[model samples]
Target: MQGLSAWRDDRCLYCDVDLSLPTGTVMQIRGPNGAGKTTLLKHIAGLSGRRAGQVSWASTDSHDDRDTFTQQMLYLGHLPGVKSALTVAENLQALAACRGINLLTHTISQALNTVHLGGYDDMPCHQLSAGQLRRVALARLFTEPVPLWLLDEPFTAIDQAGVRELEGWLAAHSEQGGVVLLTTHHPLALNCPLQFLDLQPIVEDWH
Candidate 1:
């Protein structure tokens, strides 16, 4: 995100929350509730049409950026976005398909296992608990090869073990030249160094 700003009805909500992230870096966005954390992420993701801002992927600029960004980016929102009718593996398949990925069945199962859902591959998502659903959503981290990850409230309904497991993944991604941008209220224990983007002052600074 570069020269980033967000507004609602012509009133500034998030002002100048610009960021320059390098590969192998983790950027955490933090603030109190209703501080525009999610909205800021949405703007970066190009989902906030009502907001004014310029968001670029790599050094490429806004025009035609979404196509490239979408290709390399994996976005996990506050909602798990899992389809209850689909089995765990099927949901992962859908996620892989989003990036035009084709993974073998065994590979998909292994990814589920990595997320601590070993035997739940063929089980319908509705049969799983809230945390399980979140895990299913997280399984994409393994199946997708996206280099940019935008996660909103990723820790919601996730357990401590899952949290640490995710931190490990984040570290690995950073080490492997991936960029992670996320919003969370919980403090992260990441092996990679993290940069915090506090939205509190950005919110208060808006005029």
Candidate 2:
């Protein structure tokens, strides 16, 4: 994003940040509570509509970049966005359907297995543990491949093993020339360079 900024309610949470990130970049968003790390990522993900300054993706012209950006990006917000009424398999299938992806039964099974929820496909989401629900949401990471990833508080409710596995998945995505932007309180263990931007009212510039 070039000169990307956003405001929440009337408070400017994100300042103008002229970023020229290349492929294979892994960026970490940092700040204290209510510092706008989530707001900043939301703006980049096109979730925050009221944004200031110009933002562009790659070499695309600003006037005609929305569709291109949407096609290339995948965003996972703080909430797992799972449906409590639906079973684990149904939730994944629903997400895939929304993204215009057709996931075979076997593919979904593998994704559940990868997240260590191998036998929970038929279980209702609300019946699963918080960590299990999070894993079900994270199954999208394996369901499809996109160029950009925007994840907020991805480590929430995940255990040590899951955290390590998530870091590995993110690292692998970066290694494949995908750009990943994530917000987390815990430290990351990715093999790629960890670019950080600490959001503070006094600190407006991108680090």
Compute the lDDT of residue 204 as modeled in candidate 2. 46
**lDDT per residue as tens, model 2, 1-207:** 566777766667767787666899999988898888887878877678678766677777444767677767888988899999999999988988887888898998998899999988899998988898889889988876688899999999999999999999999988999999889998888887889887876444567
Worst 10 residues of 1 by lDDT: 198-207
| Candidate 2 wrongly placed segments (more than 4 Å) | 61-63, 202-207
Q: What is the lDDT of candidate 2?
A: 0.84
Clashes of 2: 0
Per residue, candidate 1 scores C-alpha lDDT tens digits across 3-30 of: 6777766566677667888888899988
Residue 24, candidate 1: Cα error in Å is: 1.1
**Per-prediction TM-score to the true structure, in the order listed:** 0.91, 0.91
